[model samples]
Structures are given as C-alpha cells and as structure tokens.
Target: MTEPQRLSRRLIEQVGCSRREAELYIEGGWVTVAGEVVDVPQFMVQDQPVALLEGAKAEAPEPVTLILHQGAQVDDRSALASITPASQAAEFDTGKRVLKGHFRRLQCLAPLQPGASGLQVFSQDWRTTRKLTVEFNKLEQEYLVEVTGTMRDGGLERLKRGITHKGVELPRVKCSWQNETHLRFALKAPEAGVFAQLCAAVGLTPLSMRRLRLGGVSMGKLPAGQWRYVTAQERF
Candidate 1:
C-alpha cells in the first residue's frame, strides 16, 4: 500500500507538473480525489484515485462577487450565514460553479444599517471592494422605506428640498411617496441612523427600510436571505 502524502505532491507525481502548477490546479477545483473534489493542496491521501476534471485549467479562478438579499430583523452575523454553499439562490442560474475557495478572503461592502435589510455586497476582488467603498459616494442608492404617522405641513417638501442637520445644510435628494405607507428615496448612501433621523424630523416613524438599488445594481427578484453571484455582464 502507498503511504499517505500531500495531494499536491501526489498530483505532481501523477501529472509531472511543477509544484506551483499543481497547487493552481488543486486550488482551482480542477483536481479530484476518489471522485470527490479536493481543493486544498495539503489534503492528505493514500492510494486514492486522483484525477483532474476534463477541460481543467491551471490558471487561477476569477474572483467572485456575491449579492445577498438580507432579510429584515437579521443581524450582521446572521446575514452572513446565507453565504454558505447551500444558501445560494437556486433561481438565478449561472455558469459559475460553487467552489470552496470562493468563500475565502471575502470583503463585505456597504453594510446595511442595523434592523434594516436589503442588498448586501461581498466580493473577493480588490477592484470591486474599492469601487463600492472608496468611490461609494458617487453612487446613488434607492431605498423603499415604510413609515407610519402623518407628515407635518411641508414636511414632505422639506425632505425633498433637504434638511439641516447638526448645523449643516444637506443637499436635496429625490424623496417622494411611493404610496400611502412607503417613500422612495434616491440619494447617496447616508451615515448610520440618517434615514431614521430624516423620517423623524418630518413627523414620520420608519417602520421598516429596504434598499432596492445601489448604483446600477438592483435587488431584482432576489428573495430575502438568499444570495446570487453578480454576473460578468453586470457593472457597478
């Protein structure tokens, strides 16, 4: 019987590839051990049939972007729980296969406010992280806010025209009633508690808030608590 050895070593011996190439194939989910895909290069194995998948490439996999529709009442940790392999939304079909390495080293962007829910973005790419963070102010976010209570005279107009806070005059935003109980707000991402404060100043109490769009991306038909990959064709 052959002694157990590192999977990368076995792949090197079997395929006659260099150490770096073996690691790339293993990390890219191209190599399988005993019919199971093993992504870790250091995985131990002995006398197991190891083979690379058909059309396997040694190139590094592209970084993935995940968009989650966080449900209301979910905390930060709980919202991230939906990122697991099984929690992927089955409705959105894509060519990208679920890989173990895809979950590592992810950076969360633009976290939702506490007790509020909507689109949550996470990415393994530095460019995406920078676009959503460093250049975040340039993007407009659309929120559907549910509120209760009557507005004071000219309160709606005040919100549309913007209000002064902490002695600073704010820029006007596109604020209008979506219906009797909901308001559509189109503006840059505001600081934490800013939305609630804005609603309060106008004699309205926010019952719930859900972001519908950020920049060019919209939370279209993404069910709450499920996540889907941002397609390559998607921008912003």
Candidate 2:
C-alpha cells in the first residue's frame, strides 16, 4: 500500500489565516493539491500537497517594511485616510488619544502625486513604527524629480544647505545631480509639507516628483495600490 499520508487541522494555522478563512477557501473549492482542487478541509493527503487558492496567494504574514514611490500630488492626509478604521482599532485601541498620537506620527518618505503610487510599510505596533520613523531621520531619502526649467550645478547644493521660506528657517537637505534634467536629493523627516518648502527654496516649482528609495529600501516589483507584509529582517 502507498505510505499513509497524514494531514492536520493545524495546516490552517501555518497558512497565516484564520481557520474560518481556511475553511471558507476549502469549501469554496479554491484549494488545490498538485493542481487538483481539494474542497474538504478534513481531507488528508501526503505530507505536502501543492496548495493554492483562488485568492489565497501566499504573502509574508508578519509585519512589513514598506518602501513607497510617491508621485507629486499625493499628500499625507489622503494617505492616512486610506488606512481602515477597523485595522486601526485592531492595532491600537479606539477612543484612545495616545494611540492616535502613535498613528499621527506615521511619516511619508516622499511627496506623492494624487495619482502616483509607491511602497508604504505598516508596522505591527507603535514601537516598530517609531523605529522606522527615527531611522528615516538619520538615513537619506532619494527622489527622482522633474522641474520646470534647467537647474544650475549649485541649484541642488543650495537646497542642501538651508532655505528660509515664509519667515521660517527650512532645514537643509543633501542633494546632487542625477542628470542635467533630473535632480536627486536626500532629506531627513521628509513629509508632504516639506515639498512646498523645497519648491520655494529652489525657486522652481515641482512638476513631478517620485520617491526612489528610503534608506536601503526600494519599491521593487511591488505593484501600485497593493500591500505586502514586512518581515522582521526587513525592519529598521
């Protein structure tokens, strides 16, 4: 006889989904084994059966480290609005201002356009979020920008030093030339408001801006408007 194969209910646990979700998937005839659908959660097969589901793409279920490529028009208020209230409440208790403070502290690495997309990380807890935001202050943020006119050699350098705007001392940034038409710069605590300050400092309005990297993270292969879980190793 063929070797007896064993299966357990624990497979649902290992799949990083609730047993109810697993059961629903199984009942919906979405699960497959070696390319064959298995609609029964209690069904047993070999130690490993090729598992696939219609909407059950395997993802890193742990917390995520995000790298967003933001465009020119997106703002923080809109971005924060995308977060679901249910998820927010699950992560941090509702009706608690302290937790709201933690959420309010989430920062963006680049300014995004209304229609642009990039990477963004959601921390599992406030502590992890603080770590990522703090790391951004020390690390460099790179951007690929397009302006209205030709920029001088030191045009970017002036941005790196400091610029006063609206009677406020805007902090200096680290910038350099990526090409004659494209400028790259790194900033500490880059947020949506900083983009206006930068535009005022450079004396040129931003036509387009997209974040390329935050610290060592890049938006590699991640599609727009989609999210992936951040693993522990990817955390700051």
Candidate 2: which stretches are off by over 4 Å? 1-117, 123-130, 133-139, 220-235
Q: Which stretches of candidate 1 lie above 4 Å from their native place?
A: 72-78, 152-158, 163-171
Per-residue lDDT tens digits for candidate 2, residues 41-139, read: 677766455465546533322232333333235566665555542333232232321222223344453334333345555454556667665565675
For model 2, what is the error of residue 113's alpha carbon versus the real structure, in angstroms, after optimal superposition? 8.2
Candidate 1 — what's its lDDT? 0.85
Best candidate according to TM-score: 1
Q: For every model shown, what is its TM-score relative to the native structure?
A: 0.86, 0.51
lDDT of each: 0.85, 0.53
